[model samples]
Target: MEAMVNNICDIVLKRLYMPRVGILWTSGNHDFLRWAPSGELTWVHYLSGDFTKSSNHANNPCYIVESLTDPYREAKTLSALIIPNISLDFVSKLCLGLPFTAAGSLVFGCLDEQLPVIVDDTCITRWLRTIDPKRIDEITSRLCNLGFIVISKIGSTSSSCVLELDEKGWISWCEIADRLSGIGVVILKNGSRLTDEAEDRLRSLGIKIER
Candidate 1:
């Protein structure tokens, strides 16, 4: 099993050309994509972090972006090159603003439908548009670009925040199982869905997983 895994990794390293880093920091569950801005590809999975150094992976085509927004502080800057492990439940609390599945309603209107996509503070356009009332969903859903979830604060402080998207945008516990079932690049603990067959396929070619 280990030899096969290594061989699969070798193939993936050969197939991915330029690797861009995107960070996913959820409090729970695992298996997500990380985007690398410096590479030919827009984003790469966390597990295949070494793709740039292995085989022809550096030549395989991918997306590229100059900058990214930080989920921790809502700051936009040059993209990060590393991936951080975070918990699932903690992130969901800040993201959905809705606990699990609460009758399809949320503390704030934004998280009701969209799992990720928060009203980013760095971009005035997102903030301005969020308060418009008409485009709240549009604004909140925008967090998808940043790769995080958004939730509104109830009162007192009343600060809206963001949460990172898990492999399948599992901000709510109810969504975690389904997200894990889908194909994800990095096989983190608890990510049983990342079968050997799946890894072998990703090693050889580009794959698109539906949300």
Candidate 2:
């Protein structure tokens, strides 16, 4: 596991072509993609299960910002974690306007759908624009750039997508799983349907899939 982690760090550093540092901090069940403002890898520090509790994760300054209000915050990393059982009042306290580069927030909406828990639209937009097929789910329609290798047309009535991955897309499926793992997102795609081989692969890579 340690060797694999180091390899990923190297891949991100080289592929990004930036001199940014990587901070790897393990608090609960998530790993953050921390980079410097100058495009340099700094440190990879893990944090608490709750993203708002920066103090628990080495006093790192974590802030939540909305993409609609702060679009510039969506350059590189994904937004905050999905705080299950968190209330609106607690959300107000957590998002009390901090100065750190806002990663956005996830909220529970009225629809009661299995949504991506993100409150701000920025992270969703960033995810959609990404070329990684796994990252390109049909949940959000804001930035439909995820239709590169596999086009997922949004249905006005259904939240689920009927997927048919191309050979090329299937080959790069691991990349999507890795990206999601790095960002701490556990999204079950294709209505949670998958072959035993696919499930085993994702599990070995530390990517969570819905059973």
Candidate 3:
């Protein structure tokens, strides 16, 4: 199960592109600073609202900072650290308060900035096991019965399932469409092949194929 969780993390990381450097907002004192790389922490006295704006203009800016100290005082001195090469491990450690629960949302919320952020693997695994567990189990069982060796859910939505095919042979969507009733998207990995008939069948059934 641990191996499967890590594999899913790898798949999601590969599909999402992130920047090398990112801004991390924190209200914690310097005690929580060890998780970050040396000399990367920068204390800011004032941050213009413009700094919160991402490269893409569509993302709404969020700047909430929770602190144990005086809320008004702390807000003025919130530290916005420059994180280089951010990873799941770093986030799991540094984001001490409600780490796993809020980490995914925080990362996804900052997509427009191309933040070097990723959803913690434990968080993803927990969601998979907790949210609609029976449905997930049924889906896995059905997929395995259909000869799928690798399967994982990448998004919270029903359509976010991914199935990796063996590098060797072509697969026909007609052969598996009925079994995949709730799945709306399929990502083909490792140079997997899909016949023209499969493509047509999948599209006709409102299933998207991504290679």
* TM-score of each prediction: 0.20, 0.22, 0.26
Model 3 segments beyond 4 Å from truth? 1-160
lDDT of 3: 0.40
Candidate with best lDDT: 3
Best model per TM-score: 3
Q: Indicate the residue-level lDDT of 42 in model 1.
A: 42
Tens-place lDDT digits, model 2, residues 128-171: 45555454343323111221111112231232322233332233
Model 1 over residues 70-187: C-alpha lDDT tens digits?
Answer: 2222112213222233333323343454434221122122233223222212222334444674544443353332344332322112222211244532233333322221122333
In terms of TM-score, how similar is model 2 to the real structure? 0.22
- The total number of steric clashes, by the backbone 3 Å criterion, in model 1 comes to 24
Residue pairs that clash (backbone atoms under 3 angstroms), model 3: none
Q: Per-residue lDDT tens digits of candidate 3, residues 59-157?
A: 212332221223333322322123222333434443332323233333333332322121212232445566766644554454334322212233436
lDDT of 3 at 176: 58
* Model 3 lDDT-worst window of ten: 53-62
Q: Rate the local accuracy (lDDT) of all candidates.
A: 0.32, 0.33, 0.40
Predictions ranked by lDDT, top down? 3, 2, 1
User: What ranges in model 2 sit over 4 Å off?
Assistant: 1-61, 64-72, 90-115, 118-211
